[model samples]
Target: MQKNSQEKDEKLLEKRFAELSRTAFQRDIITYTDFLNLNEQNILHTLPKDTLYTRVVSFGGYELAERQMAAFIPDALYLRWGKSSDPLDYTEYPFSAVRIAPLNRKFAEELTHRDYLGAILNLGIERCKTGDILTDREGAVVFLHRDMAGLVMDELTRVRHTSVKAELLSAGLIDYSPEYEEVRGTVASVRLDTLLALGFSSSRSRLTGLIEGGKVYVNGRLITSNGYQPEEGDVISVRGMGKFRYQETGGKTRKNRISVVLRRYV
Candidate 1:
């Protein structure tokens, strides 16, 4: 019975693959997040172990040409590029067309040094050093490796910037809203060591030991003082354990105990 069921499932998968292959594939723009989600759900499962995936980023006229190639040879590679119509929507679906941010108009007009790197940097975008590079008519371009693209996109979302549009583009899958609330109370007013004594740490002495051992970082910088008073907006990253941000200092209790909220970041 189990063998029959396994055979039936395999047949169904093959049928689905055949159906997908018969469809008219077209190039379209898709967000990096969307692309990754699709990969996790559809592409990865279907891809064979020996399958080879090629990613190309082009800046110029051959956009149509690339799409044509992808449609005919769907099983050979995956293509990602910016949407020509909307421009802003960087679509990565359908395995044919994917679009990222385009070159700036001013930069395109000058055309002195045509490269995707300049435009990516101008947009304040950073790609992993090990990513790919592709050039078309547009300029310098950054191509992320298939495996690492998602991670790079996630890291880019953490950067705060003045341009709302740019920020939106970079925030691929991250929620921008303030999700965690502030825990209020005087517990927040106490020093790091004191707070740890009140059950924040395994033991008060352990907290001090961590501090003296130089195993803590506040807001990306190392902090050594056990007496250091953390406030709202302060992020404490401890070695071995995860990090948390101090949210607020609540009013004092009748027993002089304080309340506080800490946002944990893994």
Candidate 2:
């Protein structure tokens, strides 16, 4: 049943991709998609190049964004601009970034990514309109569909018990890298399950269910195999858990186990 549902979703996504390409090609303007998660972005990445009538570009307002918006650029635009113009440097990017911070840092609770996401979703905003939320104890930056930013800023007054402020910023030009804590551990191998267990500090037996349940993704591709080896520098996302990056894979112990280093995003 889950597989069938996924197929239906994929078909719908493929149709959207085709429509966006056709709209851009026929109308001679850029067409954009709502924010898409890693799995959905993977679907976009898998589309055959030959099938697309226009060039596709993706950005989520920052460098390390996990959720992104895709823009379809028509050939007519390229022709009009001449060979010297680059479409990526176009005048407008189709997303907005809002920085949310507490009124009083000393008294505020250290809110998390989940807290921000939950607060936004509770306001009746659809998940597709939101993107990567970079959160720290100081505050968070949330990417949203350009049209929805105003509503969020006006309606979002508090997060947890703290009174907050939300202000939209001039995005796309800004880049952000989230802070993380270094995690060092030893594993028998660089297998997906082993890496996840080490990064999350959880047992492989417990995490296997998450892998098999299709809730884990590595570099935007769904990974189900426990034995799948993630190369160094891979970014992994576990649904409902969080995201982390494999920083180093070296330092073999006397027992022949690999000492791995990971950056677990805070």
Candidate closest to the true structure, highest TM-score: 2
**CA lDDT, every prediction?**
0.40, 0.86
Residue-level lDDT of model 1, residues 37-148, one tens digit each, is 1112233244463332222222211221111111112322332332233322332322211123332434333222223334444444443222223333433233343444
State the lDDT of candidate 2 residue by residue for 186-264, as single tens digits: 9998899998999899999999999998899998778889899898889999988888999988889999999999999
User: Per-prediction TM-score, please?
Assistant: 0.34, 0.82
Model 2 gets an lDDT of 0.86
Clash totals for all models, in order? 30, 0
Summing lDDT over every window of 10 consecutive residues in candidate 1, give the lowest-scoring window: 64-73
Query: Largest lDDT belongs to which candidate?
Result: 2
**On a 0 to 100 scale, what is the lDDT of residue 179 in model 1?**
33
Q: Name the runs in model 2 displaced over 4 angstroms.
A: 1-3, 48-51, 74-91, 104-110
Scored by lDDT, model 1 comes in at: 0.40
Q: List the residue pairs that clash in candidate 2.
A: none
